[model samples]
Target: MADKSTEGFYEVFEVFSKRNEKTDMQYQFSLLAPNHEMALAMAQENFMRREPVIDIWVIKRSDIRKMTEEEKETLKRIDNKDYRLTKGYGYLKKKWREYEQGVLDENEILSWGEDKDATDRKRTTS
Candidate 1:
């Protein structure tokens, strides 16, 4: 059994990380620390000891405002919003074909940012 009064001192901190400059931040894991400074100091050692991380963020769990399942269900997308999706932009492929130009889709466009040598090696192996 632990002291109830001291419980408040150890706050939960959520860790997020970005692998490289071009990558988006992703949730890594969680830890308990007395304060933000201590949490930040411990974050790298605790979560990224063996991994390459470009950036790390430590957020106090109590400070986050999240929606419930019911609140999430309220969010909806209309079929008329097809222009927002890749399927809606499918016509661009045919249009590009007409001009004899390549139409790079989302994955292909993103892959352009990857290391060309690594990509070439993978293609050769495949």
Candidate 2:
């Protein structure tokens, strides 16, 4: 076999996929291919041979822009933006209780997206 390192035949490619149209894309696995097309083709056979994949992506590892240690440190700078989080509005729960009304927390707000009957049943059961 030819020397892959010198010829660049062993280029690393990261794979990502989604199970269905509504699902979020997730990391699959990495593969070595000479080019993007081959990497995409190989990904289906190697990773999705026996599974259902709604979408697939093959990105050359070298093409991804990654932050260096120094750049990453800049992201650690903190800002006083507590008002953007639910904790900042925690006093609303007590205020609502004073009015004899319930306050919807994060979980309650998120559960609104589920079936109404199911959510009601879950609330009753718990």
Candidate 3:
């Protein structure tokens, strides 16, 4: 006997779970299900029953758009252009080092947001 509900059961679902408070969610594995509800329940027993899970996401495989082998070939570009990155800006680092100055990194730039005095000074000056 053919079951109509089982026809869609071949649909794949990707399962993910958050292990703890400090860590981000990671992919567990894939499972087959008739619908999202079934997939979620099955995923819990199949993978997360013994482990800690803060959150879960059951995504339908058909809904996901993944790159194909042919498409990946086109995604490749020349790595010779470091001119677009900080590594390309290595000369500036050497220049700053020569003057006994620290290389300006992302942490220093973001720290500017924490400086209320700098913001107030800018507002007063401008």
Candidate 4:
């Protein structure tokens, strides 16, 4: 039989905070409390006191359902971000020859006009 003095198990709560309304809530820390009110208060006092936060949230750890490894893999497969890399953009060797210019390089393509002088000026020998 259970002891008369024994209390129920304490619930774990995960805290999330948003610096501003435009930003998404980020995981901050976890706290164990007997109820939601206490959890929110504890989270606010323990974590948010030092940091600047526009909003705060507290959710029960048991309520959260995590994605499986297979689901993670599926997301990886679906996200085809090769175009963001060098190889995905393909080599412009022939095109550069046709235009009588050097092939687009990493710095050149990524510069976004910041290196306008380098790109526009002809090579000089000193």
Candidate 5:
């Protein structure tokens, strides 16, 4: 009998998926597979069993250039930029209501350059 070594038979594949069309593709996990097809099959098998994902992507790990230890350390330092998401500014809604004004939400913000009449119609339809 002859012995065969499988040294570079399989490689790491990073998996990414999203729940629906509107959601962003997030890093799900990683897996080892011999090729892209097998990697995708493994990702689909794992993620599909856990959740209903609208999309799945599997890419060679070597293709991605992740942050180095120093880069990560820099990211962990103090004085990081302050970010206030819409949820963090919920109080503004009440404040604006008190002034008889509506809060400019995502849809309103996106419709800024469009026709006010069209925007109003879209809002009403929604």
Candidate 6:
């Protein structure tokens, strides 16, 4: 009887959703349901009722290829891909400093949107 119950419960399904068509689907959680249709209906109301969801997927737990304990232990390497980030090119800062040139950083770029001259005229005339 215990084995029978375990077999029945093995039909657990995981729910996932994508915020938009371009975004990747993220796992919400797992729930037990008898069939795929029932799982999908329950997932929409339970997990995505409060947020934007353009796509949904219901996958059986058994279908997922999960990593073992040994794989997880070996996967904990440092993510030192400095070549992929601005931090890797930090030497450019010193090079620019030698030229006495200020870097056009994010703040300076955003400041270009401010119409300071217009605002000054409005303040003086008003």
Best by lDDT: 1
> On a 0 to 100 scale, what is the lDDT of residue 37 in model 5?
97
Q: Report the error of model 1 at residue 105, Å.
A: 35
lDDT tens per residue, model 5, 1-126: 322565578889999999998999999788989899999999988986889999998999999998899889987748634354556666877887777664566777767756777888999999
TM-scores vs. true structure, each candidate? 0.57, 0.63, 0.53, 0.53, 0.49, 0.48
Model 3: weakest 10-residue lDDT segment is 96-105
Ranking by TM-score: 2, 1, 3, 4, 5, 6
Global CA lDDT computed for model 3 = 0.81
TM accuracy, model 5 = 0.49
Backbone-clash count (model 4): 0
Error of 1 at 110 (Å): 52
Candidate 4 Cα deviation (angstroms), residue 6: 5.7
Error of 5 at 102 (Å): 32
Find the 10 residues in a row with the least total lDDT in model 2. Answer: 96-105
For all candidates in order, the CA lDDT equals 0.86, 0.85, 0.81, 0.81, 0.83, 0.82
User: Which regions of candidate 4 are displaced past 4 Å?
Assistant: 1-7, 21-24, 76-87, 93-96, 99-126
- The sequence of per-residue lDDT tens digits that candidate 1 reaches over residues 5-99 is 98778999999999999999999888989999999999988656689998999999989999999888878654578887878887987887877
RMSD of each: 21.5, 18.8, 17.2, 14.6, 19.1, 16.5
Residue by residue across 31-103, what tens digits does model 3's lDDT show? 8887888998898776655776778888998899989999999888846767877777879877877776655
Error of 6 at 33 (Å): 1.8
Model 4 scores worst on lDDT over the 10 consecutive residues at: 117-126
Q: List, residue by residue over 1-126, the lDDT tens digit for candidate 4.
A: 545554465778999999877899999889888899999999888765597888889999989999999888877756778888899656677666777664577787768676765656644532
Q: Model 3: clashing residue pairs?
A: none
What lDDT score is found at residue 100 in candidate 5? Answer: 61
The local lDDT score (0 to 100) that residue 59 gets in candidate 2 is 98
TM-score of 2: 0.63
Better of 2 and 6 by TM-score: 2
- Kindly report which residue pairs in candidate 2 clash with one another: none
lDDT of 2 by residue, 7-104 (tens): 76578999999899899999988888979889999998876667898889899999999899999999884888889988999998788787755555
